[model samples]
Target: MIRFETAGESHGEALIALISGLPAGIPVDFEFVNRELWRRQQGYGRGGRMKIETDKVHILSGVRHGKTIGSPIAIQIPNRDWKNWEEKLPVEAGDPAKHQAVASPRPGHADLPGALKYNFKDARYVLERASARESTSRVAAGAFAKLLLRALGIEVASHVIRVGHVELERAATWDEIVAVTEKQDVLLSCVDAETEARMKEEVEEVARTGDTVGGVFEVVVHNLPPGVGTYANWDERLDGLLAWAVMSLQAVKGVEIGRGVTAAESFGSQVHDAIHYGPETAEKPTRFTRHQNNAGGIEGGISNGEDIVVRGYLKPISTLRRPLESVRFDTREATAASYERSDLCVVPAAGVAAEAMVAFIIAQQVLEKFGGDSLDELKRNYDGYIQQIRNF
Candidate 1:
C-alpha cells in the first residue's frame, strides 16, 4: 500500500511531503533528486518565482545514513519567497489591515469557487493552496520513485509534443526523449529543433499580447516488465491509475495513454498493435514482439513489456498578465480580474510534472506486485517473476 501526501501553501514557509510503504535498504540519491527539482524549474515562459526559489529537499525523517529504514519518509522544501510574505501571512494572528486580501478573483482560477466554499471574504486563502507551486513536493516524491524504478531497469522521461499551434507530428524515440529532456538548454523540451523553434515563436507572440498559451506533452516509460498492473478491479487498472495521476497536476485538463483519443476515430484494426513472435535467445527461450505501440505498452489494464506512453494536455496559465473581465467580490461591479504574477506558458513544465506523476503511479504498482519489506527481498521476488515469464 504505497502512498504519499503533501502539505503547505504556495507561499508557505515550506512545502512538506510524506511518503510511506517503501522497503528498507533503498539508497537515497541526493544528487539525482535535486536534479529532478532543477528540471521542474526549467523551460521558457516561467515566472519570477523560479528565479527566487532554488528548490532543495531537506530530509526530516524516515531514513538514516542515506538508506531507507522501512518507515515513512518525510521531506521539506523551504520557500525562499516566504520571507517577503512572513509578516503578511504569519502563523499567529496579525493586524487585519496588515494582511493582504484579494477582493477580485481571477476568472480561470480556483479563487471564486474556493472562497465561496470556505465562506471567506476574498480569494487570498483559496489562491494560496490552489497554486501549482504545490507540485514541487510531488516532484521530490517522484524522484525517489525514479530511483526505485532505475534499480529494476526501468526508466522514465518526458518531452513537450505541442506548444500553442506548434506540434510534433511523429512520435519521439526513447533515445530522442532522453536526449532532449536531458539537455540543459531547450525551447520547451521539444525533441525536434525546427518544431521547438516554432514553439518559441508562438510563446513570444503570446508574451507580447499579454496572453498565455497551452499545449500537450508526452511521458514515456521504458524497459518496464510486463503484467505490472491488474485487470481484476477498475481501480487497480494501470491505465486508469496513470490517467488519474497525470490529471491530478495543476492546469492539466486532459490525459491520454498510447494513442488513446486517436483510436476512437479509427477502425479497430488500424488502432490495435499486432502481436509477433521473435527468435529465442539464451536468456529467453520464447520472445514476443510488437512493431507498433499504439496501445502504449498497456492492454487489458496491464503493462505488456513495451514503452508506456502517456500524454497530458495543459491549459494556459489561469493567472494572466492581462486580466480578464470579472466582478469584484465586495463591490459586485464588473472589472478586470485580479492579476497575479504568472507564466506566459507552462506546457513544458507540466510535462516534467506529468513525468513525476507517472513515475509515482508505476512505483506504487511495482510495490503492489512485488511486495517486500526490504530491497533485497523485493528484488528476489521480482527476479523470480521475470524468470517465470521468460520460460513461459
Candidate 2:
C-alpha cells in the first residue's frame, strides 16, 4: 500500500518526509516539488516564520538520475531558522538557562492537552510538533503524489472560497482554478480578484485588532475516471477517505464533499445529479455525462466520472498575538495565554495543505485499484481499466 509519514518539529533542524510503495520509473521534478513548498508559504496574513524560512527539499534516498527506483523515498527540507534555534532546542541535554519555556498554555492550541498527556512542564515541545509548519513536509510528499497522478492525466488544485464574511460570488471553473497557480503572486488563492481584495481587507482589519480570521477552501480533482474507490466496505468509501485526509490537517475543523452540507437541507431532486450517455472521449472514457455535479463526482462511495469536489473549513490559528485567558502550565494559576509570533490569517495556506492531503489520498486510491511495481506497468493497467469502462 502507498503510505507516507513526516518527522521533525516546527523549529527543528529540518523536516523530513518518507514515502513508500510508489512504482519505479516515476520522474522526480525538483523544481515542481520546491514550488509546492513555496506555494505553501504564500498568502496574506502570514507571520514572521515565512520570512525566516525558505523551504527546499533535498532527496536522501530512493531516487537516482531523477527517477524512482522502486524503493522507499526520503526527503528533507532544512529549516533556515534552525541556526537561531540550535542552542535553544539542541538534541543533547544542554544548559537549562538557554531553554525557552512556554509557561502558559494557549487557549485553543495543543499546548495544555499535549503537555498533560506527556507530563511536560513546558508547552514548548508540544507547540513545536503541532505547529502548521509540519505541513511543509506533507506538501513535499504530496508533490510526489501529484507527479504520480499527473502521469495518469489527473490533476488536483485548490482555491479559497471564503475569507471571513467575504465569499466568492460564483463557482470557480477548472481553468480558473488552474490559472490561480500560475500567478507570480498568490493573494488568498481566490479565483476572483474582487473577492480576494475583500479577503485582504478582512486580514488587515484582523491585524489591527490583534486577532486572526479563518475561512473555507475547496479542492478540485479533475480528470479522475470512475471506479477509483470501492463501496464494498464502509471504510473503503472514497468520500470517507477524502474527509479523513482533509480533516487530518491542522486547523481544519470540518470537511465537506461536493454539496454535502447543502444537500442535507435541500430536496433530493435538487441535490442529486442526472446522468446521460454521450460519445466516448479521452477525458470521459465511459461516455457517460452528468447534467450537474452537485453530488460532487461521487455517489455510493465511488467516483462517478466527474470532477471531485472537497471543501475544508479551517478554524483560526490557535496561537494569538493578543493572547487569551488561561492558566500557567507549571503553577495552574490564572494567567494570560502564551503569546507567540503567529499569522493573522492562514486560510490560503491551509488550502494548499489540504490540496496535498487530497492528492495523497487520491493517489493512494489509484494505486490500490491499479497496483504496479513500475510506471509503465501501472499505466498499462490503468489503460486497460479505461478500455473496460469504455466497453461497459
Candidate 3:
C-alpha cells in the first residue's frame, strides 16, 4: 500500500516525512518539490513566520541519482527559525527560565484538548505540534506524488474561489487557473483579478478588526483516466478519499466534490451529467462522453475521464490578534486568551496545501491501479489498461 507520514513540531529543528510503495526508476524532481513548498508559504495574509522560514526539502534516502529505487523515501525540511528558538526549545534540556510556556489556551485551537490529552500543564507542547507548520512535510510528499502523476499525464492545480463573502461569480476556466497559479506574483491566488481585489479588501477589513477570515478554494485534476476507483468497496471510493485528504488540512472545516453540496437542492436531471457516444477517430475508437461535469469527473465513486474538481472550505485562523475569553490552565481564572502571531487569512496557502493533498491521493490511486516494481513496468500496465478502456 502507498502510505506516508510526517513528524516534527511547529518550531522544532526540522520536519521529516517518509513515503513508501512507489515504483522504482521514477525520476525525482528537486526543483519542483521545493517549488511546491514555496507555493505553500505564499498568500497575502500570511504571518511573520512565513517571513522567517523558506521551506526546501532534502531527500536522504530511497533514490539513487535522482530516481526512486522502489524503497521508502525519507525527506527533511529544516526550520530556519530554529536558531532563534534553540534556546527555548532545545533537544536537550535547557534552562527552565528559557522555556516558553503557554498557560492560556486559545479558544478555537487544539491547545486545551491536546494539553488535557497529554497531561501537559503548558499548552505550548500542544500548540507546537498542532500548528499548521506540520503541513510543510505534507506539501513535500505531495510534490513527490505530483512528479509521479505528471509522468502519467495527470496534472493538479488549485486557486481561490471565495474569501470572506467575496465570491467569484463564475467558475474559472482551466487556462485561467493555470495562468494565475503558475505566476510568481500572486496575491489572493484567485483567477479573477477583481474578485481577488475584493478579497484583499475583505482581508484589510478583517485586519482592522483584529479578526481572521476563511474562504474556499478549488483543486482541479486533469487528464485522469476513468475507472481508477471502485464501487465495490465504500472505503475505496474516490470521492471519499478525496474529501478525507482535503479535509485533513489545518483549518479546513469543509470539503466537497464537484457541485457536491449544490446537487442536494437541484433536481436529479439538473444535477447529473448527460452522457453521449463519440465517433471513433484514427488514433482512437468509439468513446463515452459527457456534455457537463456536474459530477466533478467522478460517477458512482469512480473517475469518469473528466477533470476531478474538489473544493475545500477553511475556517478562520484560530489565533486572534485580539484575544478571546478563556480560563488559564493553571490559575483556572478567566482571562483574555493569549495572543499568538497568526495570519489574518490563509485561504490561498490552504489552497496550495489542498492541491498537494489531492495530488497525493490521485497518485496513490494511480499506483494502486497500476502497481509495479519499476517505472517501465508500471507504464506498460497503465498503457495496457488504457488500451483495454478505449476498446471497451
For every candidate in turn, the CA RMSD to the true structure comes to 1.4, 0.8, 1.5
Candidates' TM-scores? 0.98, 0.99, 0.97
Clashing residue pairs in candidate 2 (N, C-alpha, C atoms within 3 angstroms): none
Native-vs-model 1 lDDT? 0.90
Best by lDDT: 2
Clashes of 1: 0
* Model 3: lDDT of residue 104: 92
Backbone clash pairs in model 2 (N, Cα, C under 3 Å; residues 3+ apart or in different chains), count = 0
CA deviation > 4 Å runs, candidate 1: 281-286
Ranking by TM-score: 2, 1, 3
Which regions in candidate 2 have their CA more than 4 angstroms from the true location? none
User: For residue 210, what is the lDDT in candidate 1?
Assistant: 92
Global lDDT of each candidate: 0.90, 0.92, 0.90
Backbone clash count for every predicted candidate, in the order shown: 0, 0, 0
lDDT of 3 by residue, 36-110 (tens): 899899899899999999899989999898899999999999999899889899889889899988879998899
lDDT, candidate 2, at 261: 94
lDDT of 1 by residue, 1-392 (tens): 77889999988899999999888888999988998888888888998989999999999898899988989999999999999999888899977787888779997789999999999988988999999999999999998888888887789999999999999988788899999777877569988888899999999998999999999999999888889899999999999999999999999999999999989999999999999988865533237878999999999999998899999989999887788898889989998898877888888888888889999999999989998889899899888898887887
* Candidate number achieving the greatest TM-score relative to the actual structure: 2
What ranges in model 3 sit over 4 Å off?
Answer: 280-286
